[model samples]
Target: MVTIETPRSPRNRKSAQREKQAWLFMRASGVVLIVLIFGHLFINLFSGNGIKAIDFAFVAGKWANPLWKIWDTLMLWLALIHGTNGMRTLVNDYTQREGIRKFLNIALWTICIALIILGTLVTTTFDPCPDTSVASALPQFCK
Candidate 1:
């Protein structure tokens, strides 16, 4: 016999609102992510000399500007949150144990937060000039 499991908790106004917000966020973020991803790819692989031009200096030059920094940060944040939420939904649906479901959801959000922090830090704090003992190995722009 097949059994239909119902929600553990009855839906309330606040929870319903939260669900609606999450759904809206997923849709909006997905559209933005598509544009950001495509733009990133176009710039990285189709502009100028293409993939061959994607060296340290190429990255440095892009990051040195504020616009690219914002774009990348947005992409990172949106993608991570979107993916994490999707995973959380999956865990909730599949896991029969309450403890397991909660644990997986917490782990997902923790990882998402950690990655977003690290990625933002790297993007915002990127330094084009590296002071190296051997300057020859450094990009020409570093000189």
Candidate 2:
């Protein structure tokens, strides 16, 4: 018969500097996330006509202004990156298989990159009233 001992908790071999930097990043990102989340909510859910104010025209109006465009772009990138990083941390902590962990991390980052690119493009270049040299009856505003 053989007896096996359970493995001890993983030890931190990282240097103090590296550990400190990681800690700092987590804290900073967390703080920024709070601000971003709240501000986004306040803007989208409380301002103007509230959620009902969200229309193609409203989006176009927002992008027409540079400030809203910047705000949206920042929010998109920050939220995606922050959420991805947090998920990465969770996966790292809980995942026991190296192969699965690597695959999940790759997938997470890939999706984040793809979404960020697509979202940024959409927000920056969205046109509510598409260019139609001809006339059409859709929304009077679009016409």
Candidate 3:
């Protein structure tokens, strides 16, 4: 008896492209995160008044700036995507069952979506002073 070997389908090629894209994203996001994270730390910890200067008022001031908003937004999105995709890779590697892999991927994406939504809302809709009645408790700049 003779056995025949079948060629890979287009679906396999598409899957390969997705894998390559994921790998490329991992490397690119890693490089970007390093720069953004370090810049964030340096600005917050080593510049000007340094860590001691960090307070509710400081954060409020940073958020007031559109540039910082964009910076933080980019950081949030890139980190979440990078981390989720990393976890997805891990799940694919370690999970042997088809069902388990699918479940985990769905769960990862759900969490990522939740986080992205929550973080974006918090960053964009942040009110420095929600209760204006409590003037003293709020930041000095709030008045």
Q: Which portions of model 3 miss their true places by more than 4 Å? A: 1-11
Predicted structure with the largest lDDT when compared to the true one: 3
- Candidate 3's C-alpha lDDT? 0.90
Q: Sort by TM-score, best first: what order? A: 1, 3, 2
> Per-residue alpha-carbon lDDT of model 2 for 1-143, expressed as tens digits?
88866744445756556646766877887888788778878877897789987766667666777888888888789888878888987887789999999999999999999999999889877766776663352235666
Give lDDT tens digits, candidate 1, residues 1-143.
99997766735889878878888999999999999999999988987788878887788888878999999999999999999998887897799998999899999999999999999999988877877775765577777
lDDT of 2 at 110: 99
Deviation in angstroms for 30 in model 2? 2.2
Task: Give me the runs in candidate 1 sitting further than 4 Å from their true place.
Answer: 1-10
Steric clash pairs (candidate 2): none
RMSD of each: 2.4, 5.0, 5.6
Please tell me which predicted candidate would have the highest TM-score against the true structure: 1
| Candidate 1 TM-score to native | 0.88
